[model samples]
Target: MAMARRLVLWGVLAACVAAGAGDWSPGTATFYGGADGSGTMDGACGYGNLYSAGYGVNNAALSQTLFNDGASCGQCYLIMCDTSKSTSCKPGNTITVTATNLCPANYALTNGGWCGPGRPHFDMSQPAWENIGIYQAGVIPVVYQRVQCSRSGGVRFSLAGSKYFLLVNIQNIGGSGSVGAAWVKGTKTGWIQMSRNWGANWQALSGLVGQALSFAVTSTGGQYVHFPDVVPAWWQFGQTFTSNLQFSY
Candidate 1:
């Protein structure tokens, strides 16, 4: 029998690439973290340290509408300060950043609730914000576009959890960046499906210790990549492994 194609469940991501890299949409932006992005660690996407994760200081926490409940984690966006809407905009400048956190809504705050539900906003890192807007402009209007992530290396999987459970954090992804689904396979066993456990973490209930690990990942943009025996049988918790394979987008 012929094999069935994977289901296209994340059709929303199609809109992101509808017009390619030049497709810009209106939005608002504010800065967070210190100038060096030291305060941007341990974000909602579970990326403990952006610098260590190879994301550097150029990152942003997306508002609820764009965040899509962590599904947007790892996605990249190109944003330019809109000169037409704000005097503080530094024209001819744009910055690309990865989605690493959530700018949660604050219903209690009246004037400062730019991240409120349904709003398109970006709470960018200070360094990223300073790249396109004046420092004095606490918030600036911006035109943003979903862009492909250019990563320096292959995808990285950070392992955590106990013998009874396995929690994997996928990072350094290119292409669509956001993971839609994942499956883990052990050397001695067949492919085991994993479920999203918040942010970029995927979880598996069974333990496959002492067996080499492989992964099959599908991005929100419908791209798929597979890594075979990426982790040795001696893998341990808290250790990270890098795959030679990556999606080119």
Candidate 2:
């Protein structure tokens, strides 16, 4: 009888341990490294992707886990630079980065393009995301996806007060009609026309030729023109349309 009682007790203990020792609660999933303007924005925005990111340190502890159950949040981001040099939240992005993290060391913050109010901004004026460090206690392996080429900022130029020739590479995603149009924001409302040299310098195609094409831009004196294909507006080339916006100058 004692042997059976002890066996039952052991079973009860095992069940209790199992109840309390479940897989560590998942924190906010984050994503880092790779081109920002690419489709990667979907993952960075926590839509869904191969990698994950974002979470505080030592999240497995039983106490701090009560702060948030992550019932409705699955967002994440950031990564270590070189595993030795810890200073500043060196993001893995390679384009125009506007750091919005109020606290740069603990974790990452949401991205609110252009510095506004207390939004953080990492000056892209020099080498970045180098010499990152990690700890053994709170430091755990997060997800980092290395998808897509960093081609967004490979050739972004602005003409503040002059007319310039720009060469646009046009490529149809699939169909054979309306290759789409390129627009430029001239420091005002509505997008202006982006021209192309048909045979000399630049050339732009109509909506009936290909899905992708380049256009020239001209800014009057004291006027600033920002290309529409700069950010957030990707060459929609997915379904019957896709854009291979390679370069423009």
Question: CA lDDT of each candidate?
Answer: 0.85, 0.24
Best by the TM-score measure: 1
Tell me the RMSD of model 1 versus the true structure.
Answer: 10.1
TM-score of each: 0.89, 0.21
Among all windows of 10 consecutive residues in model 1, the one with the lowest summed lDDT is 1-10
Model 2 over residues 101-183: C-alpha lDDT tens digits?
A: 12222343234322223322221112222222122212222212111122222223212111233233222111110122345
Model 2 misplacement above 4 A: 1-117, 121-130, 135-212, 217-236, 239-249
Per-residue error for 89 in candidate 1, Å, reads 0.7
